[model samples]
Target: MSLLHTLAMHRAQLPLNALRAFEAAARHLNFTRAAIELCVSQGAVSHQVAQLERRLGTRLFHRLPRGLALTDDGQALVPVLADMFDRVGAVLDQYADGRFRAVLNIGVVGTFATGWLLHRLDGFARACPHIDLRVSTNNNRVDIAAEALDFAIRFGDGAWHGTFAEPLFEASLTPLCAPSIAARLSSPRDLAQESLLRSYRPDEWRRWFEASGSPQPVLRGPVFDSSALMVAAAANGLGVALAPAAMFTRELIAERLVQPFDIAVDAGRYWLTRLLSRKESDAMRSFRHWLLREAEAETPLCSE
Candidate 1:
């Protein structure tokens, strides 16, 4: 009957599981889907939501004939619960192997991921074992905030809107192809006679030709969405590919592909970018430092 006792009882009666069930159900607007996500039966999810509604003394969702719709109260509560869960999950993830391990989610360009980062990732793991790294590879385009990524390694001029960028290294574009194709190319002008395999960017071959002091030729090669595939096509003797020669070190060393000319054109550099609105976490800072150090060691001639 005491005020303090009543408050304590109220706190004790707060159902955490029911709250989570309701939140998940509300997010999906479907009890069945929420049950699937929570790995429970639909009846259990419905019961939890019903229990939560009774406790709160209000209806949080409307049970439609086909789907569910959140009430005003539910809409207001969803974000708060979501944030609370996220913060708690983040804290829990930080503790591993008797040490704090911060989770860092980064999106990298496919070219850089395959060409450089994947090969040297072991070194990063050794250097910073306390950081949990989750990497996703994308094309040059990405939405850092929408994807909830901590950092994005992309190829550009470091001018993305609402992003802070640090240059990693320059990936100069050059003509690469199978040895059979390379043997026929005595001059940059000779590229006109072969199938000039192209990437999404149409001006790459033109830029290389201009840099080589050769007149730009009319290109009628197949266009690929990724440099990796473009290089693969060239290695298979389909056509000459204009790509970053440094990225295909393995192919070049194995004699699967060869650079016919020494000339390379700079289109853009790889950059470590994060949204300006995002504050750097401990893990992000650590990874950024490690990346910059590695870039410096690998490409001493390239400047940030």
Candidate 2:
């Protein structure tokens, strides 16, 4: 018989008590210890383990002079049984108040994750205690289906081919720099001489220049994949960053970074996206509603 079929047959033949006895005995490598743990007599524990071994048609333990040791088959079974028990316990935990604590896996761009979402996570946890939220950060490039993500918060024009995009907020790009850098002579044209920090996107500076009615200068600077890091570089007086001002409000408020001009470009907005084929779950709906409400409170800017 195939190994899978053999294991399946063993599972059918073996009782849970027998499996538990073996697991506890294997863990401690002693029948008396396992008996104490299970609140049963040592003989009962040994009988259960012998029953399990007979059912499997394999000796699971070696009766050593000092105590006990697991055989190769016992070693192989330990982790599998432990994992199954852990999964069962986790599922049981989700049954509180007759509500399942649904798991919601979401991917977020680093910029939003750190600047906005992190601060509000405690509020989300309190409001949706029945939802187990798992967040992973990216750099605006994500594959929802491939990554097994239920939702993704990204920066873009909301035009992905197979996604249902819901706009969160308009993230406008403005020229931001350090206070020392901001002290330079005024005028959008003055950006000609500054070190222009760049994102992987080549057109942000150009767009900002066009929006400010200034000529785009020859770009030469380090490229960054994450806006949070790029903004940090700008805050450290490295170069001028064309970034969203609203997202860096904390840095701006602390005077770590300074915005040089009011002119902003509509590169795109932050969007909550999921695969068009994925049906919305209760957790997904709760998250979307919470996100939209929070985004609205920031300003009535969540797009339809």
Candidate 3:
């Protein structure tokens, strides 16, 4: 049969309810959860799935005692149905106020989201009302392709494999502590007597101490996976945290955390990264231009 003729025949014969049931069930691999999602009973879901299997003339799933598993046919159909549903949802969402809204999905590091991006998002929303921005925050580690992200704002040396990274700005590391701890310290050597909260990066304190003209002390403290959490601990007087001072301006301004010394070290920088193989969409281009302009405005240019 011709492709068009096959599609027409299926269009006439296939039921939309059956397709929806199958898609939901295939995604969850459990008819009960799919039933709850569809607001239908388990029997209803099972009936719809059976109807789809009969019409397609193929067994879509392997029924187990506990749950369900997709056969080759089900696996092939899942992605198509998921994409179709997403497209439908996107179109329906754009119908608000008779304006078409373009959806943009961006992932950012938690520190950047809290300290910088969150504050300036209102401006972006106002400037680009037609773009619907969705954000997800991580701890400077993200898989753009797997997470279905258009862009990922990460902190590193801008050398991630298979990614195109544009430097946003440098974030230097410095010793930040509570006011009480700062009051007790007179010089960089005083840090050795206090608890040093550490992050995953082992060499950060060593580099900071070297920059401060002090010998690196033996660090035996609770390690945090994120700078945001480490700074929080420092603010709460748990220990002194060596973190990026630029990203913790709110805490510093509120006097919750203070930079004890004038010394700082260049650990790495923040970068706006995207998959090298992915083509830039219109929304991506707009966001990139807006981000670069904002970064330039925020950071002072160095004298040549």
Indicate whether candidate 2 or candidate 3 has the larger lDDT.
2
Clashes (backbone N, CA, C under 3 Å), per candidate, total 0, 0, 0
- Residue pairs clashing, model 1: none
TM-score order of candidates, top first: 3, 1, 2
Given candidate 1, what's the lDDT at residue 260?
A: 90
Best by TM-score: 3
List, residue by residue over 1-304, the lDDT tens digit for candidate 3: 4333443578778898998999999989999999999999999999999998887777889999999999977887888789989888878987776888888899998878888889999999988888999999998779999998999998888999999999988777788899999999999888888999998878888888878888977898899888889889999999899887777877889999999887878777789999999999988999999999999887621100
Q: After superposition, how far is residue 162 of candidate 2 from its true place, in Å?
A: 3.5
Give lDDT: candidate 3, residue 56: 75
Each candidate: what lDDT?
0.85, 0.87, 0.86
Error of 1 at 52 (Å): 1.1
lDDT of 2 by residue, 1-304 (tens): 4433556876766699988898899999999999999999999999999988887778889999999988888888888888888888878867766887888899999988988889999999999998989999999899999999999999888999899999888867888899999999399988888999999998888887888888998988799998888889999999998887877888889999998888887777889999999999999999999999998888521111
In model 2, the runs with Cα more than 4 Å from the true position are 15-86, 93-100, 300-304
| Candidate whose lDDT is highest | 2
- Provide the lDDT at 174 for model 2: 82
CA error at residue 158 for candidate 1, angstroms = 2.0
Q: Candidate 2, which ten residues in sequence have the lowest lDDT sum?
A: 295-304
